[model samples]
Target: MTDSSSNTQETDSSQYSVLNVNDWSENWQAGKIGFHKDIEHPLLVKYADKLTGGKSAQKILIPLCGKSMDIKWIADQGHTVVGVEAVEQAVLEFFTEQNIEYSKETLTDIPGDVYKSSDGRISVYRCDVFDFNRSYKDKFDAVYDRAALVAINRDDRERYATLMKSLSAPGSRMVIVTVNYDPALHPGPPHYVEEELIPKLYGNRYNVEILERSDSLEERWREKGLTYFDEVVHFLSDKS
Candidate 1:
């Protein structure tokens, strides 16, 4: 399966059928992750300070986190990392591939199990994002969303943001990476999230700032019928 920050060669869009949300687990199980990246996202390194908001130690939440290497990078930075993934195999691959010793526990309260590093610095919950309970809201001090929103259908984008808000602490901040493109050109797993929509989604609770924009991905994804492929980075924090 592709990591959220897939750095591999881009596949022709016509080569595959549109991804169905219900088939996410199947996709992972089948190793259909052309989107996966072996390294941390450049933006995560570039805007670390802003995401952390000068806080030295934080509990960061990652939604739909596949076995991306960024989770370890975040943990290496002295912050506790909590990730949510729907596939158990993905979670296992993360720990096994990273050589991190971890223990798994079934959560009686939730539909899935919790896997944590031996040091307790990182935890990943294996469950559907919607199955995630609201009682745990306001637990994370920061959030890192890379391609998660784009991976979902348009109908679920707003619902995704609402869940993220619930997980954020009062003064939490986030670094969200999205692609800005003409949606009418190509349907996407890396969907087009127009700049205007960011405000409508997160602006009600936090101040949103556009940190950077680049068309570097046009070369890789142009075959997908994109006239322009912009990688937009945003920093969001509570209004308070």
Candidate 2:
């Protein structure tokens, strides 16, 4: 996922802007993606059963997915994985580095392109997440929101949440992983997401539950002057 803007957290609602796609592209081009993890996220692996509901061939959506290894992992489990990303560089790197043979085609209904794995199990849409709309309404059975929500600007959350809802089918489940820290210390692509914000975003359509919270402040964040860091996991079940 592309986390936009400078390191300073913006408090004024008026100052918040839509994420910068070019910034993300630049990051990818320059190899400035420290946010990219080498392995599957530990939290995601820990809670895979909940996301899949012990079922196979479920349709899954990953928003702002930046070549996440989890996409390949989930697809290997016999599920269909769909990822939405903005930067072409990240998308290409994903397939090339993973050694997955893929084909690409431009999307007629929307801007950007779609890349599909030869196995037909994984597809990644190279477009801004916001541009992907209700055309995919009720398409996914579950969502894995690892870096998407936290990477978004605060002002766009409602729109983002609504988009998520529009894409998900009835009874769909979502697993979210968020990193929390004092915004005063450092601005973030992985911004501090307040616990209260979860319900505010999804309460109308989903039952939200706090699954776990742990101290996850890495040494780098500590060196950046953050006093504390908390990583939280949330589970959401559609109300319908």
Candidate 3:
């Protein structure tokens, strides 16, 4: 499901196919996740102060979190973490490497296998991110969105934003990290994320702030034969 396909038909078909738990699981079984980060993203590390505000004991929602080490960091800092990942392999790998024993059970609420790891510090639902029932909505105090938004096609951006908003409690805080790249050079899962789209998506429901914008991804993009990489870290509050 995470494959970067130039085939518009295949890509369009994925929108419907991804909703099926079995088909989505097959995508994971096929090892199609080219989007997983090898390391915890630097922006997430650098903006730790702004993202978490040195606060502990908050529950954080990580959308499309694929075996990310960021989950552990947030959990260790006294935040309970819940993440939704469509890929089964990534969820399985997360528990194996983190050395956390987990229990698998069917969630009648979401129609997927729910794996609760590390004494329930982390709960990962192996299902399409969009299919999760709204009973889970407004249950989180914070959100950590890394690659989920831009990884999706432009048409799905509003749905992504709506789902994120639903999960967040009033006055909840969120940090969104995205890379802005040129479409001509590298059409991608790391797709073009217009800066303006941020506010249009969440500003009506949240107070938005751009914490940083820099060409930090330059070295990596240059290696891929691309120029002009813009990375942004945004802090949002549900105060509005």
Candidate 4:
């Protein structure tokens, strides 16, 4: 007979499905993520000044920041880095992989543990994205989106944009890296967000610019029986 524990594990893995904090926790437990990179994204390095509005020190927000190396890169540049992620496992991995010491606490008005750096430059709140409180509105000087946007399903894109815009301080800047592709050819968690949708999403409140586009990941997608992510970067600024 097949092991009952194995069957239960498989069922939980697919059932939660990244829709909430519990789901992402399961995702990490199963090691299903392949999008993680140990190095800072080249696009972020190229446009760091633009993202921070040429400021060396600014408060930055990164959503869905899995154990990605980009956070370490930005923090090392002398800016405060605040990231929100759903999985505690991923948060721990970040500290472990980067060799940074952190302490965890159960914070009020938030649904998950808050892992904070020893020196206070980095903070990762482990919580469902939507559960973040509105009291944080207009609090960030800049926002960075590498894999955050395309990682979510399409139905939540509007809400995601609205939340990001609400958190912008006056004249705040944002650098969003997204994937665009033929939706029919891929199973997309890194979903295809068409170019036209950017304006519909953030144009009303922020000035938008298309900075770069590439097919560097095209071959990787083809290997997976799909086309490509067709990576694109966009720069956005608050109108106010």
Candidate 5:
């Protein structure tokens, strides 16, 4: 899943149901990914230093990554990049499109496979993000969450946030991009995440900072009758 740039028309909240793995695969197969961007997200480019700290070889994690070009961009910085995506098609497309040679291995502990770049700088776990857990505790030095949080079911956000915490090392950092819009206008995979919710979710362990908030309502959202939309970026650091 990408951001709020969905090609489908907005519908009533009741018409939208929480999507499952098969549903996501169907979306990919049907080419319904207007949310996917051809270029790396600008916010990620602008605020990358917050995560990388100008250091090389940092271990970075991307959850719910959908063949994002940012994966390659981050790896090119001489860091190790790990991404978790549930769709096999998306994962395959990433390696093929990027022209990166890779090897795939079936994971012993999980139901999915891991795809690793020939250079060993990038690895993508093809599995449900929730199933990826503490076996890799304190593994990541930083995380780039461009669309992961906003793409999940609202009911699963707490679990998702907890998982993020567990996967990160002490003093780790994260950058997240979220969207806010009237749910009544468009119930979403890119759901309305209130600004207040971030601190509530991670305040206990991480220092939270709002990096940017912009009026990012695209023409499609405006046409869907959304009076306003705000795209927000947040930086979070573990209070170690």
Candidate 6:
């Protein structure tokens, strides 16, 4: 007896696949995503003023750009929007949901595809954010960081800041919105991003502005069993 039952269980475990980056990519290929937001986030709406003042048609970069509606809102204002997402399925669904026909192409520097509209009005790079440094240095005029900062474990945040700084130009502007919480109870991608740390990382190269901070997050959070969260918004500009 070759333990056939045990072999069958192992095969079944493999049947559901794994959640590695590639598995996440295949999930996009299969169109299964639940992390996407159906509407443009309120943070974008409430703080639009902090993000708006600039040359017309500025190129904006959105990192870890899940299928958020912010891309359409920004692009509709005549600005070019470029987003980088690690999940290929989310990238494909974003274009499909928007009803914008696009062509798929590979990024020369990273193992990912580019989904671009025919007119180049909107484009999203399906790749890891870290890979952009080699090909995308000084490429964006502004960066909109929503959820990207908190979505990763805190161990990598410093690297995240460094990569973001590298991709932006001198005098570039970025709006970073993150929520704060206690790590002891609320293990996160809801990870606690302390407000005092921006200057420690980017202060040498950028001017940091504390645009807004409040404890009045939406009421739904408390119901989710997280009792504490502080909404924080920052306006970052390169001082060069």
Q: Please count the clashing residue pairs in each candidate, in the order shown.
A: 9, 1, 0, 0, 0, 1
Scored by CA lDDT, what does every candidate get?
A: 0.81, 0.85, 0.75, 0.80, 0.86, 0.73
**C-alpha positional error of residue 115 in candidate 4 after TM-score superposition, expressed in Å:** 0.8
| Model 6 pairs whose backbones collide | 28-89
Predicted structure with the largest lDDT when compared to the true one: 5
Give me the candidate number with maximum TM-score.
Answer: 2
Each candidate structure's TM-score, on Cα atoms with residue i matched to residue i, is 0.87, 0.92, 0.84, 0.88, 0.90, 0.81
Question: For model 1, how does the per-residue alpha-carbon lDDT over 1-240 read when each residue is reduced to its tens digit?
Answer: 334344222334321124444467778877878678889877788898887887877999888899989899989999999999888889999999999999999987768888999999999988888777532454789999987877766667899899888888888898998887766665566777778888899999999999999675645577766677788998998997
CA lDDT, candidate 2, residue 52 = 86
- Which segments of candidate 5 are over 4 A away from where they belong? 1-16, 134-138
| Model 3 misplaced stretches (Cα beyond 4 Å) | 1-6, 9-34, 135-138, 216-220
Candidate 3 has an lDDT of: 0.75
Deviation from truth (RMSD, Å), model 4? 5.5
Residue 127: error of model 4 in Å?
0.4
Q: Candidate 4 residues 1-240, lDDT tens each?
A: 123233221221131112445555766898877788768988899999998888878999999999989898999999999998988889999999899999998867766888899989999988877776532444899999988888775567899989887777888989998887666555456766778788889999889999999775645677766655578989998888
Give per-residue lDDT, candidate 1, residue 108.
77
Candidate 3 lDDT by residue in tens digits, 1-240: 433342332432232112234544665688765555667777778876666656768888898888898888777777789888877788889989888899988777766787897577888887778886443554788888887776666667899899888877776888998777765566565656777888999998888888888685546578878778787888887864
Worst 10 residues of 3 by lDDT: 11-20
Which of candidates 2 and 6 is the stronger one according to TM-score?
2
For candidate 6, write residues 1-240 as lDDT tens digits.
122233222221121111235545655666554445688877787866556555678888999888889988888878899998888768877888988889998778767788898778788888877776665655788889987876654556799888888788777888888777654434444456677787787788878888777784445556557677786888887887
